[model samples]
Target: MWTKRYSEILLMTFMSITCTRAESEFELRDVTLHIIPANTVERNSELNLTCEVNVVSRGGNTPDLKISIFKNYNNHNPVYINNTRSNKVTYTIAKAQASHSGIYQCDVSAGNQHLYSSEENINVTGLQTPELRVDKLKVTEGEKVRVTCSAREESGVLEYTFKNGLKVIYKESSSSGVVQRFHSLTSTETAKFSCSYSIHVGNGVLHSSVSNEVHVVVEELKFTAKITILPSTEVIEGDSVYITCDVEGINKNSSVLSLSKGSRLLPRNYSTVVLANDSGVYECRAKVNSAERNAYKNLTVKELFSTPVLTITPAEVFEKESFNVTCRSSKIASERIGHDDVKYFIYRSNKMISSDNGIYKTMAKNETNGNYTCTAQVNNTIKWSQWITFTAKVLVSKPTITVLNEVILNKPFRIECRSDRGSLPISYTLKQNHTTLSHVQVSNPSQKAVFTTSIQSIQQISEFKCEAQNNGVNSAQTSDTLRAQVTVPVGKPNLITVPVEQDITENQQLQFLCGIPEGASSPITFKWYKEKNLSPVYVTTVNFTNAEYTILSVEGSHSGSFYCAALNKAGKEEVSNHVNVSVRMARWKKGLITGVCLMLVTGIVFAFVIRYRAMRVKVASSNGAGIWSVRPPVLDSSEVVDVDEPEEPNVEYTEVLHPQNSDPARVPLRKGTDTVYSEVQSTSPEFHDEF
Candidate 1:
């Protein structure tokens, strides 16, 4: 027995030494452990742990061993066991809790030898819970906003959750490596948001922080400014006008203000003041930080000015008369400065004749007659307010009259008057021995006044004077007076004849008479003349109203010439032309009975004588009487024969002297012829006896 027991002991001792050498060879190989499902834990879920081993084969690979997982490195508390004989192992904790979250180990054991073992720590995260945050607490609607969500206490990657009142509106993953941005968020979108995250941790799910709450105030963007114009009065050119722009209620603090004419901007200035050159509308604008506003205004400028105008009242005046004149002006403002102390000057002929405080005055005695003007002067220059013109006149003086000639009956004469030189109206008056004769008014301004009158038989005696008056003033009486003379005269009577003849016979007696009219006053002289020479034919110087003288008989001497003459107190006058008268003896005045008886007796006696003388002359002529003997013998004293002579001559003798013949023998015989013879008486007586 002893011998056999010793032999077994020796064999056991040899095997134990061989086993130790094999374990040392296996220890020289490298092994790695990896856990599945990461090292993080999540709440209300299972914890799955996977163990993996990476082995490097060194050339003695018998078979890959199986792996086992232990919780907290304890072999008795096995979380997983794998019998498949591989290098990887997996362990799962179902219904896991916060208490189950801890470090775990992976073990790979074959037979009774531990091949590989590794420990991994795991953290339990409540799930993939995410938190959200907003950078700004309050934001206007339609503004760009940022929403962020992150895992709690772990930052693997970031994501953003955008929601509107607990509703997921948008989501972006942090895998893009950029911050998520949301622009122009609405008011509803600024409410509560749901967010979650996933990160690389021990747990498969991610934990989120709290949900961020933000109040959103929707604000309407307002960009506005005001425009103000300075010195709001009547403005003129070349004057400065100031304009300003005031910005208000803008969205941004930093902005620019723009001023323009139409659309062009002017140089930079907040308040603009410029010398106005044109008149129109001006525009101003304000540009805020992304906002704009504008304003406009109109400006005007004037060119002309207003002043005072002058006028004159009652533009004319009379000479030497006291008349009121007035100067007037209009459109003068009642609030005019220093106008109450204005002075006016009255000017005539371009000379300042008078001056007054309000309107100028004229002298009561007019010195000159012409146009008068007025002007108002301020300082040295004349104001347009006062200027006017008017006309004036003067009066004339009275007149007096004088007479230069005397007036005669049935004659013509004239009178004259004189006056002083002036412009007033004047008239003249004529008087006869202080009694008014005629009154005449002279309208023209001439030198003298004259009147002409005639003297007739009706007015035998008259005296005259003249006076003149003008403007109620009379001139002195004239020194000269007119005189007159009166007289009467008669006319001579004319002579008449029966037969107008040149001469008269000697025996003819004509009648001559000197006479005048019954009422004629005359010392008349009646005388007859021959031709124009005076002959002593007849003369009668008699002063009688009706005187008559006669020349009873006229001879040849009265045929020479004849005329008459008459004289009066006026003058002496003669007969008109001339008259001639003739006278002769009457032959028919003898008695007719005596003339017849004497004619018969003378015839008878002449017959007897002629017979006696013829008987004797016949005896003588029978005896042949010669012519000398027939001349009867001259009778002697004894031989004278007696002839009976009657008491009156038998015939009247008429002078029968013929101028051409003077011989008496050539006288023709008066009666019968002379003859004596007796023979035949005897025979006649015897015959008577026988019967």
Candidate 2:
């Protein structure tokens, strides 16, 4: 058992070290964060925070980054976040307020690695004016008035001050920059109240401008009426009631007295058993001609019971769960005069659905969801509670993150997050590893949430995922990691000829290769083109970078500016630099030169045959033992002949002659003569009549 444990420990340690080494190649480092205007940011001025970081990637491609600037709000959630491939990110606050002053730090994430910057607590030099609100603008002397002072959405260790007409009435410090204070009216006068707040900064304090004033009036009674209810202030329905009113310091003989309920009149010093409206305000009026004084009081009539309140036993309800809805009142007037007094009925959308005596039970489902209310009744009196609503929530299934298209480096691509089953208004968060890329809320259940993003490196493909939430709970359903194809655009093609200068002669092999040095997507298609031609001379697709085109018998027609275009499945194209291909000779010109050379060789060989025949005639003549002289032929002659010796013996050359019309130097010596000798001439015996 000890050996097994030791082996397991070794395996775990090895795995941990291997994981660390793998991530060591990628680093998020040199993280530094700062703000503009080094001293302080004046309120209502533009402020900027800059986060700069340096990263090392696992490979040659740059790693994707997530930079966030966080404040002490909502558990340090990011106030500004950016999904980028750049080294620096800047967040701007167009109008800095008191709330903008706080401790802030920056976080930089590269791949699976993270780094954080030191915190910077900045100070805003100015403050916002607090707003003062009063619950009662007019009140009697010694009556309590509620006053609330609030700053502009500011928090974190603030001091609030409340003043009553330039006198400090209350002061308090709280983390929430809002405070409520109650001030009792002291005298019969109109008083103006205002408030201000302060923030503690470095070695000093910053106070806000005084808020707008709220005026409160304290009224003192001079001549008023006293009212009393008989048979107790709390009374049962259909009971007799008594009300008495007395006015102070009134001249009874000159002034007429009037007692009224709402708009009806009653006799003064009334002592009567009465039946009246269920609820109304009673007032006493003393009128002396046109000078009249009045005082009013609101009298609340007693009901069989208070308004019913409908509540669910469990605050949260999900589909397929069971809960109860109960209705009850705080007080009941003892079931006045009925058998089933204070009976309860529950309603669903104003339609009575349950008469279960203030309680109902049902399963939480979509079919059972609606607005519900309950009522308590006795005789003709009824009290209905406010409506309570239930919309059953459904737990979201695991989300699926799909890459809508093949991911292209540094180009925006769409990722869709979808849950097969969930309620409407689902919240989806797209994430890269542990860092959030973006958030989307899908209110329409039929549609999926889509987010668009780009990455700098291909390694981030496996790190992308999404999470869905709608249950109003802490847990969220997450999708599997993204898996999709990746493509890098082909770089510029480098085209080169076998002959570096691209000059080649006819019948010489010429080869040109199109290649990319780096950053090419395979398999790549290479198309070779000549100058300004729409069609390609050679087309090929290959997995390797280079594609070669060879011409075994190069022709002059192949000469011109030539280049190649390269494109991959990624659909990005690049053209190579053009190379001028100059062939020395054309096809027809070479054929013509060859024909002329063949004719020249044939003429030389024919001349040699004629000379051999002339030499045979000469040898026969020499055997005849004498030397013979040749004579020129006459002008305008068809043919010329030459004798081999002085004694003409052979029949092949009958005579040797020269042209008499031409000088000897001007005459042909061996060929091309106006008159020619036999032997080296076209007019020899070997010559046919075809000449």
Candidate 3:
């Protein structure tokens, strides 16, 4: 029995050994391993992977498989892996990073028998947060701008938040993308922004890093302005100019002010004082620190005008005479108005007389003969406050006269005429014995006239008158009457001697004689006077045929009045005439013969000298003499001769003895002889002659 039991144990043991060999061969198959993500993982993100092993046994029992995960198969140790043999095994990672990505493999074996094995890649993809970007790096005040955020994965929606410090100013969420725009934003409103994404990450939302801070600046408001004047369109002197400043987009509290002529800053209180003399453009500017807050207004200062006053002197009325009219005004302060700046316009009889400097004067009279009135304009405004009027009347003047004498029928008489003085274009009329004698016209009126008439006989007294008239009115008149008396003589008297020069030479005698034919008037008286003095020098009465009177050796003291008087039956008549005489030495008698002799001798000698000089010149000219020809001949050709050459020769000289006797019939005299010689010079030498 022992032998038989040993044999069966040997057989069973061989069978068990064969079965174990089959199981080992089955476990020798390769293990198949795989991971959920086979390529990449995001930094600090979960890496979930499931590793599996698929084995097919060759002959014996199924093999146990071992699997592990590593970062790099050539570098780092396994982070997590499953080694137990199952159909497949799962690996869960809380966070996966670059360190969690590597190669993975599973090993399958039965005891010492080898099984199938496989390898896979664990990628560990990275999950990144969405990033925000801005179109502009910075923002200015009142500027419109935008911000954008995006993700490379395109797996979820993104939301953006813009903040200034701790305050959020802008927020936008969009599933399409994270791009937001902010329009018309103040600089203080925008600062920092961040982008958040709605993605699957361990059960919570993820946000990206904030973008670079965006800065914004705010600017001040701007303004514009203009200025204008009211009422009158033109800016004139002395006129009140209403100034208004129009301003837009400027602060209300700020004022518009004018600069004082040359200043750059605004004046105090932003107001300007207007003066009549001040004229220029004025500007108003708003006072603000911002460039946009400043504005300007232009104000123009116009010149002021004044009215002038006109006054007439001498009451404006005159009797055909001249008078003066003057204009006056109160002095204007130069600071308020310039001297001579006011213009004066004088209106008279609808005529305008202009004076820029304002002081005017004029003369008025009846001769002026015009209606006069004046008006003044100040600052372009007409002034009628001052006016004047006047009238002139005809003026009378003195009278003048002209004297006349006439002789008729052996009798002498006088007449007078009158004229008006200082009168123009005067007329005159004369009357005698209640009858008009003559009428005369005069350019200037005068009261004076003269007339003379001879009276031989008269039957009655005669009257004469003269009158001067001006402007159709009688201005002056005068009249005179004279009685006439006559006596007849027996015969005409013979005047043997009449008193001549009453002023006789000293120590000289004067004589007078009278004669009458038979049957003449009985007694005739004669008298003598000097220059018609009050007293006569001599008087006598004679009725004879011859009468004579003589005063011997009369002196200057004997000179007196003289006259002749005849008395007969009717009335006595006297004739008196003035005489004047003077004594002086006679110039011709003083040196009569001596003066004649001197004049005669001087004239003869002058004529002779002139004749001699003219003859010498005639002779020299006839001979064609040069300066050298007039000079004395030299002893030898080399001898010096002091000769002044004549400028030119007289071509048509007369061969007369003297220029004073330069008649063509005269002949030229030789140098040393009184005989006349005539010779004509020919161009041929054969015609030469010596004289």
Candidate 4:
């Protein structure tokens, strides 16, 4: 046994020496181990380990090669041991857990030979929960606010995450603390803030916790001063503009406010009726105690449309000559190059001839002799330009002289000079028998001159002529001569009726006279007619020069229509207005006849009264009683043969006697008589029944 033991030890020692030699040789070969990603990784991340050799020992009598991966956490045991056919090998962990983080090593072997590489370490940290704190709970507008974040516990490495209402604002990793700052705060900036801290423990394992949420509020600044502009910024020309500055949340009496246009300070706190020249950027500043506030705005003012300029080429043109006329806008308006801001119009003789287009062309004619004007406007704007007038000068025609009234030997007459066409301010000269009679100037081309003179003092056959001259610079512009014939003056006569008495007696004579209104002209005769259709029945005699007609005895047959006519030596006859003559008796005569009739009726009534008295006395004496007997008129039997008797007579009677006592049945007797009687009794049955 001893001898066998010794031989086995020697064989093992020799093999060990051989293995050491091979290990030494293999160790000399370049070998390296590398992690696939970075050595440091987040939790739950994949990891890979790779081992490579520069060259495999193929010359030596070596066995098959294999790669083994070892971890420090597993008692330095091999986590991955596999034989490889190539010089390089890789080990992968698809999902790395925290337990996989440790020191790692790879061993390279050929058969029973092996070598270990340098060790690599991977670490994992637990994330710490954070606490957020602020210097203040609220902040003022335009003021700065500060915030801070602190880790809950001491951690390996903490990453502080801060957000403003779910939006990540700041992210930083540090072993210490973190802070956030806000320079300015606005009214709309109201949000909650939270912070969280995290760390990687091992194998990409992440641990985190949220801090208590903190909210911040921003308040609007205090009210100070405000500015208001009246009538808006955009305005047309001549618009009333105003600006007012008011100080609020403070006392106006203690505050000083100033309004300015550019750098020039205004005197008043408010401006009224500002003009376009005042258009510019304005500022309103208010100062109370030491606080100052300012407001600014830009003011714009539009200009009113300007008067258009009219220009006609070839200033003076003759008939049938073509000319061009152009209307242009103001210089300030034309500078607006790209906009259709202005429109033009052309006027001739105060009437619209063209619109929109500024250029106008026309052939010269008598009809185009009047004034021309133009205007411009814009769309949706009330601005308009003033109308400009320019009179167009043109060539004229010859003048014509006319005699206005009849010419007499010793009377004054009128002569008018006229021209068909020309510009205003024309000169006219009147001539008689080729001698200058009078010179006159007419401002209007259409007007003429009237010359009143008598030819009695001058020579006979005084032929009148007139010449017209234009007012233009060209002296050659003149008119042809026009002639007038002279003749004796003859009047158109009118006859008038002479006034006559309205009332006339039947035997009274009536007379009428017809005379000319212009007084009688020599060699003129008058004639009278009874009606319009018949010829003159009476002609003026030697004594009746004015034409008078008389009736010896006026009667109703003389009432008829009458008219008169006057005829001159020139054979021109003129008739007077028709007159109707009516003959009437005097009204006093009718009154006298009515008075005579009244006198006769009075006399008849007096005689009737006398007769009635006589009859009453005779009837009274013939009767013995005081009763009266009214006897009806005796009629023939043929007149009253079948007449019906009336029940009672319509006649009434009075009692002359009265009773002494108050008894109606008894009648008192007269002083001389002893008899007493009642009222008279009627013989008819109707009287008894009525009683």
**Candidate 3 at 1: error in angstroms?**
99
List the RMSD of every prediction in angstroms.
57.9, 35.2, 46.3, 40.4
* Candidate 3 deviant stretches above 4 angstroms: 1-422, 444-462, 474-491, 494-546, 549-691
Clashes (candidate 4): 11
Cα lDDT tens digits for candidate 2, 1-691:
9999999999999999999887687676589987886527777778889999877667745567888998853325788989988889999888776667778888887766788888888777667778999999998655679999987456557899899887899999987767899887756788799998888754567778899999999876344456666765556655566777666655667556777876677776554432223566777776543345676766556665677789987887778889898988777667565434668899987888888488899999987789999987766657788998877778788999888887888788899999888777789999988898888989975676889998887788899989998876564898899988888888888999997766788888899989987766688999999999999999999998899999899987888999999998778778999999999885678899999998998787679756755554332233322213332334754333333324333333324232223223322223222233332222333333322
Residue 392 in model 4: shift from native, Å?
29
lDDT of each: 0.52, 0.76, 0.49, 0.63
The TM-score values for the models, in the order shown, are 0.29, 0.39, 0.21, 0.26
Write the residue-wise lDDT of candidate 1 on 1-691 in tens digits.
9989999999899999988776654321434555445566466456666665554433555344666676665778776777753555556666444435556776665554565555678666553344555666565544555666554443335555666666667766674423444545544333554455444434444435545554554454455766766675345433456767667775334657766666556543433333233456767777653345678877674421122333343343445455554443332333432455455666656776666553545543545444556655433434333334444533444444444454433445567765655443556778776877776677776545677765555343446666665545433334345443332223455554533344544445355444556544345555555567745456666667434335555554555546555555434454534555444434453345568777887787778866755544322223221222122456786334445534332221112222234334332333234222211112234333442
The CA lDDT at 210 in model 1 is 42
Q: Is candidate 1 or candidate 4 better by TM-score?
A: 1
Give me the runs in candidate 4 sitting further than 4 Å from their true place.
1-126, 152-160, 167-177, 188-191, 197-207, 217-220, 230-303, 306-691
Worst 10 residues of 3 by lDDT: 654-663
lDDT of 4: 0.63
Evaluate residue 629 in candidate 1 and report its C-alpha lDDT on the 0 to 100 scale.
17
RMSD of 4: 40.4
Comparison by TM-score, 1 against 2, better one: 2
Best by the lDDT measure:
2
lDDT, candidate 4, 1-691, per-residue tens = 9999999999999999999776765333656879968677765566888887655453653345677888874525788987865777888877554445678887777755567778888543334456788777787555556778886344346677778778887787886556465534544478588888665544454656778888889776564777778879866445677887777876789778888887788764565554446678888887754456788878887655544678877876666678777877664334333235667778887788877778888887767666777776654332333443434554445777777876544667787877777666667777766787887787754556777766753344346677777644443233334334443323443344333654455767766676665433355577778765577767763322355667678777666787777765434667777777777766777899899998987788678755753453222233224343332346776333222453332223323222222324434333223233335333444443443
